[model samples]
Target: MDLKAGWDGTWQEFLQVDKTVFINELISFHSSLDWTLELEPAQRFAWETEYDLMKSMLGHVVRESNTNPETCWVAFEQELIGEGGKRAADVNLVLPTGDLFVVEFKHKTEASEHEILRANSDLQTMLRYHSESIGLVGHGYLVLTKPGAKEFKHSGVVCEIADKGQAPLLTNQLITSLRQTGSYDVLRWSKGEFYRQPSILHGTAQVFFDTKIPTLKTSASENIEEARDALLKLYQHAKAKLKRYVVVVHGRPGAGKTLLGISTVASVARNDSVKQSEPIFLSGNAPLVQVLQHTLDFYGKRKGKDVLGRAIDGRVMIEDLHIFKKHIKSSFGSRKETFVVFDEAQRAWDKASPRDSQSPSELMLFCNWLSSQSFGVLVLLVGDGQAIHRNEMQLEQMLADLDNSVRAQNGNIVAIMPSLHAKNMRLIKPIKRDVFNLKTPIRQSYTEHLDKWIEAVLSNNSALARDVALSIESDYPLRVTQSKSLAERYSVELQNTLHEGNRKPDAFRSGWLMSSHGGQFIEEVQKDKFKPGKRIGPWYVEPPSSDNSCCRFDAACTEFSCQGLELSLALFNWGSDLLFRDGQLVLAEDNRHRRQYDHYTEGSYRVLLSRGRSGLVIKCDDSETFEYLKNCGMRVV
Candidate 1:
């Protein structure tokens, strides 16, 4: 009743044996699974089909033995808990040497990328567990039972497509491969590989593996997926009828508009209708674009070059908005690149002035080109409200451009937002039906209550903020320190907190959140540390090279630099420029912050406070201001 293939290293010595004897010995090592109408009792139609096929492959001897008392046990209905969540293995086989083999069954003609990813995830968990806990090896086998299942390879592993009665042999080979090599072909996240040091805000290099936890899809992402589906449906219709459409998708800060837009482009690459079309994903945020491009390059070095290269191929080109604008002017006709998705679309600039002649902003020009030249093109404009710059066009201006002469004739425009009222779009006719909204927030780890609390606190709604803050319990711990010395201590503590909850030291990301008004303090802090060190540029791009805490202390980024990014922890320095009096936010007389604090300071603080996913430590340098904040019910440490 030993169902295992008995791969007990005996075959290694059989190389000297006669051909017939070797063949017989090899066949002897081959094991069989006990088959009975009641034994496995196929759970589904696919399982029944696989079970019958397995029975036929086992021959009469193994089939007859199914009725006898069982001696071997195969793992079925197995589930394991991972750091992310619960995962299950459809079929598991234990080798004679105690090595494990797993099979993820797909009944369809082609196993999906998502299915492969799930199988790989299950494999990694089993491999890590068996190696660490049980001193055993685990190999993954992705089985596509149905005919014509597309075979593919990822990382170093492969998608196995098996015809009728061929699964067991493939499973044997998979186990043998694992036994031969300690590791399987899959994504093995290593420490120190993708290390990002804490910003000048926190002065430490923490190691963090890019392990995006697989959770239930958030409402925002779900809505985005639905919108993406709708987009594709429209695309299909447009393709058949030879029409064009403009779909606007808007969200608030931390609403995942960037990731959603990128994902939409990737989705288009996978679709059959527009798989051939090259997708152009453009973002005006240079740091965002650089981070994404770096992501691909970093993986190219870690993952085999050819693997990712093939996976990406001409499918996607993530471009800088300025570069795209420059290139689109010279290019003409409906090329292979048909789909265009723009992130932070609200930042698209409008034409300056007729007298100044700034080459007629990229917005109007791109819209004109899309309208007049491109055929059956679907444009997805993903907008957010992080417009910290002055020259940036608002959503209203972008819509006005969309309603221009060329676009109106070529395509119908739609506006979407994250709220009931599509802000600044009231001027457009038939606005009510065309505008849509996505209500959920998905980009941050913070919960709804935390989001509301942060918003209320930033908006100076003292009562509601206090109420919301008191009721909410979140991992994003907020602490306010009155003393400068305590603030310094808390900054380090926040960095340490970034390493908590199963996160590695190298992965911890922390930064200093300072207002733009504190330029003199930053300059003094910088000049004292490195004598001749230059002023701190964007923290995301030009972080201080020195690991010294003194140097890092000087490198603080304001809302303009740190927006659209998240940190694990942050040290928010509350300067004298903005203070709290009796519960209301009060701008001081010598206010250096000229960009409308009343309208934008709340948003700036919102951006800064929400940047830290784990925690925020606030430092109120002014004693009176600290006392005022304390009276406002903020947790003062």
Candidate 2:
């Protein structure tokens, strides 16, 4: 088997590390019976020793077994990257019959509930890897190695074989016998669920995902070239000065601010820096980081670069703001990083924000930290709109009274927009003296006018929204509806359209943007009931797909879940969280599910409305809201 092709690129280098000596050591350790097995029954073995013991057992099986040639592979401490996090199986054994058995060893007499759950999660990951690499599914085993441990059963039974004479030899025989008979079926306990799915980039996201080696955008239009040139100029200016620089890149949802920031950092990495500091792209959104990291890693593998090692070496770091903050704290009185591209800077909180009650706000601390840097530092604060949460400190609040001591310390703050007088209009006039605008809407599938329409609709300016909508050119269809059933039908139609009749296992993703608040209401109205056992997760992971008696329905993907990602089509279940009346938007006061603040209500809807590049079908349950939209001459079905 070509292990290199089956393994993720990050693990390619690791697979080459010599293991022959380790295997020989394992054989020696097991054959001599010089282990610490005679220790007190209550005394647990060390984690490393337990792990090594399992590996030795697997190596022993491979050394002794006379099984088929194909399944004669064994790997110790095999690391697997899952959507949730990194999972490593203590030992992995492959059988000649294209069967994989992943075993998790516990040194303790009784495994804790958390340990068992972790093992189950590891099992899920192994099954997915097996399916991908060998074209077959696999099972996992939980082995307790404490002396005199009793076997226990849950979804899968726990095996106890500690202190028995030649225990490793016996366990190997048992596993080999099971593999030959095809009797081991531990995966049945977990029902074989895989979290990560194939992702397709669309609109602004696609544009960003496609920019130059690092960027993949096929089009190198004037706007992108201009932005790249301007960004390079700013970097040169920052490098020449001893003073700190703070630049703000503000644009509409699809203005490519995020892309500009990422590309600038990647561009900087191509050249050596005098300050000996690498640029790091930071965001508060976890999903955004995951998507970008995965994309970069995929490209890095093709180029034979260890992307994970590069991230570790700080060549180009894409990390969450929290981790960045931790790095800041860890690097005291010294700055290891000189340049930072902070995405969604507006989301940072104020000192009075509830999330900052115990500590200074992130913005305040970040600014303070940068001011104290020994050398020049450049901060690209990229963001748009107001606070989504009540306690969030909006960009306006953070930039208040910009002409202060910080600015005097060789600090420069500039606003980058599409034009001096842009339609989205979130720029600060007094603070933003230096302005640069990106005229093109890279994320908009059709005319940039659609973004203006979205802004008007979100701002509750019904008149302007209607006018803009009339003049808009859409590449995809848009339908506003009151009937939930019709909306669902349109949703399936859009899903089929996104697939383009490609019968491949995973061609594209399509789902409904349901409000998190009305779980009961959604269940009652939708054709398929949400899965009985599955709970909704954050934006990074797709929710479990539910199957009704007649058809399968993708779980309601939420605003937070779909924030940094794009969809081929979005079926928005316009909930009561935001209502329309008298040509104005109103927040439903009595709505139990209203979690986001009033300031964020508009921005939230705007994000959801713009998620799909191909199509958008709005399902509004409220009669007044439906009529209001209809009166505005919306394409209501």
Candidate 3:
């Protein structure tokens, strides 16, 4: 019989056959399998399920057929040879337009990796055959029962067959691409014309679009909310005033800049009229890009519409602002309704060299573009001046550049400064005042107690150490130093001690060690011969208990400073007559010119004061300094 007749007859017979008998056959195959034969049952099941789904997937391709006859022949169970004649493939169907489809079957019980590899291999082989066929078999598709297995990485088009309880739905995106290409033969072969199912697919995509995308909102603290509200008011005012306006928001680190940007986008997107012109969220940060892409993908699936324009549909484009600017200049040109939100505005404005002059800063150029747009466009700039910059301009100059850019475009500028440090500053007050008070009487009597407490807290409680470490700002400059030879000796000794004590020391784990120029230091001690679990660092002379040693480079010290110190005591030990000698509490006399010195001195003072939680433990290195501090109500230890 011909290929079409054979497929129809085989399908009818397969469906009429008793399901119990088919299942029994599968079980028998499973029972009588070796390594090669082990996959027989899964293969057999997949073949049957894929054959069933092909009819639905093929429907989409068939509808787009432009053949004179209006009806096309379908071939199944055909064996075909490739170019070298060394490989052969069992094809599921060949359409009248000469499109070759390699079908694979998969069950939920099959290993996912195996299925993916198999699908990829089959698609590659089909692509090879299709290329040789010279558009005869215009495209190749791998039809499978596994709906979620959609990512086939080969070049040519591919599709997935989603088996609904009643009838399967065709989900191969190749059909859409073929239709969009406007190639009649390719469309017919891909079955683009016949497939007309609803766009909603059962999975994360569906949930994201219908629910998550529409309701997406920015997370904000009290100050952030205030700033967001203010920005929204400005956006509305601009929208009313000139029908559009450019807004610039600048601040320091941990400021609520991103929060305001997201809120602005969400507010504009939620509007009924502006919903069609969805705000485009772009960023250079990989993690942030992934989050935004995921959000956009969810939105696209649920909406059942191409919301992010045809070019960006079902995909998130991540590129530098320069590339994005080129695209905008080409694609949108003078279109004013579409809103583009560029996060990380600092990177966009970097023009340090002649090479950069050609790109022009994205911030400045974008503002200029908004000014020239006929219908007016809203440009929002959100960035921190302290983080990373391309220029050597002062804060005043940076602000001036922003102001100049706004004025040059006749745009409005607004500033919002939200500090995480300022918000969390209150939480540390109790610990700072009563527990760490240097002038308190309790601190005077319990000088030794305070030292032991800090040691005990660091050694026994990892969580507390992490908290304390994080509490210390990065500005502190306390450093720890040790000779390289001594460090190596200590590392070997510590490893040996741990092994003798029946402890399995991890090479990666070491106690907090100090570095001389600020920052924690940890290094593995190398012995005469390399040994497993034998390592040394500044923190310990012997391998400390895992509970007693926090992982080096793993502590949370975003706002704190730490250093390794060589001391005789297992815990905190200090000499008698611990006295607070008058030590110079260095302060940054000038913030702009001496910022580094200012940070170091201020942070050192904070750390010194905060170290004695229960009371001040002052060791007098200088009598004058001690007398000065003592007269100031500090207890001398």
Candidate 4:
């Protein structure tokens, strides 16, 4: 077999290093390459025109291989840029047999664990996509781009041996080419018992491919950019001054506070001052943690200049805030990481919380404790909202005057946050409110008037709420209905519209949002059973294609479960948590354990109303609240 397809400019632009060696390495893994960079060194020779007709007669071209030659190709879009590959991945190679191979070129002479996992994650996603799309075998191939005449050595599994007891993956042409460079043993992989237990990244092909790492955004909104700049300065100050620095990035429900946190983590990782250590991201919000972790695997694709500034890898240090405490409790103070990003730091548990978990405030004190031992800089991502749970809300009430909460003892900053003296509004000073705060509303991002209308409605300002409601009605559909079936149908329609076709499942998430704390009243009134507690995480992240997905209409999330999470189309069921009494929203007068404070009740609705990225649909079967909302100009269906 021979590589007859034009090697072309695509390969040259993608693989910036020595193309020949890469080609030689790649070709050796498979029997044939579908692409040809240039005529091989031996094949480039031609007889001299000295009437070398004699040599032509004597030197007959022999058949190259016993196997029949076939062609391989790739699908490109626009400027023929590759379609199914990330920038860090060198190429998504289509073989002559119509199979796909995702090639990741690493500069490592001996790949580190981080490099291995990152490459595997990228390859796994692409290969899975390829196999699912075309029903053809897909695999991952790694090429170590070592310099000079040094042969790349990988002590671990190589793509050469695809699986246990399998013959080498070498094609006839590749074998020939590889032999000219080095001995067969140099490239051969032994299928030992150790190699049999394949990694998740290599379910089939013994190669890299695992996590679906998302490309980070370099361009952010002005508010988020300002917060990030302020955070960077704080990070630098913390690093140099050797003290704990807390910068609270606050904003309206959806104004990109989380994005600001993500940006800060990326900025810190790239900061030259802390080259010895990378920042870790911690969050009390499990769903947010899952979503972020899903996007940023342990170690994301590390690209040289081939990547845009947008692709920031090494978001690997992400963990649920509680889990971090579990793993490193003993070494908390001496941990090498100098900077940390805590998502939804306001919702962090206090001393009143379960003894098993460490509160956000406790973690802050640890940040203080670490200042002398290592270094400490904690960037808190707080949002504008009331506490979601009883423990946190109660703590908020107890420490109402959080300004006086801090008490330094033994020259150590004792932030009595919950378990410690928590700061009021979760704000640890040394902050420029304008620079650190994110004011503009980005939640219900499609409609600027959504938050205002919700705020007005909760505050019983009917005229202002009505005016705001009118403006956003067209873009942010606010629908009310008594029928659960009707609400589900409309949610399905909205979700379908978001996807358009079989583009991808859960293209934009749509699901039911209701009060999480309810009993028999919730069951009979709301009519739909919600998969509460730990199950809420998957409901947000799982695609509609899965039965477990929130889009399935079989599941729902409460205010507690979805505080920082959102769906594109949120079908909210106004539960008995809040009731209309004396022209105001009040906590429900329920006999069960659903008793909540006024702020908590209003805050719950505030969270529910702003949960939808595109629009909100209220399933309020109750006539009293329904009439109140309908009179406030909520679109009735």
Q: Rate the local accuracy (lDDT) of all candidates.
A: 0.50, 0.51, 0.35, 0.48
Please give the RMSD to the true structure for each candidate, in Å: 17.4, 19.5, 25.0, 19.4
Candidate topping TM-score = 1
Model 1 Cα lDDT, one tens digit per residue, 171-274: 45543443442332111111001111122122100001221211123355466567666666766675676555555676766555565566556555555434
Better of 2 and 3 by lDDT: 2
For model 3, the stretches where C-alpha displacement exceeds 4 angstroms are 1-220, 274-278, 284-287, 295-320, 328-338, 352-359, 375-397, 410-637
- lDDT at residue 458 of model 4 (Cα atoms): 88
Name the runs in model 1 displaced over 4 angstroms.
1-215, 236-241, 270-276, 305-316, 329-336, 352-362, 376-385, 405-436, 443-447, 482-506, 521-554, 581-583, 596-598
Better of 2 and 4 by lDDT: 2
Relative to the unseen true structure, what is the Cα RMSD of model 1?
17.4
The better candidate by TM-score, 1 or 4, is 1
Give me the displacement of residue 116 in model 2, in angstroms.
54
lDDT digits (tens) for residues 1-637 of candidate 4: 0112223222223233244543443334222322223333432211011012211211221133221222323221101111111122434444333344554443334544334433444443343222122333455545443332123333222433212211133233232332232221200111101101111111111111221112112122555666667667766766687656554555556566665666566556555534454677787766566655543332233212211234433235566776665545555544566677777666655542366465344534444345445456666666546576655633343334223233332333323122223334454433235566566653323346776788788888878888887766534567888888887777766544322212333235777777765433232112122533335434555556766567777656776667766666788888776777778766666655254555677777788887776567788866888988887778776
lDDT by residue (529-571, candidate 2, tens digit) is 2435223222212321323211234345555555656655567
Off by over 4 Å in 4: 1-220, 233-237, 240-243, 270-275, 294-316, 325-331, 348-364, 393-433, 443-448, 498-502, 519-534, 581-584
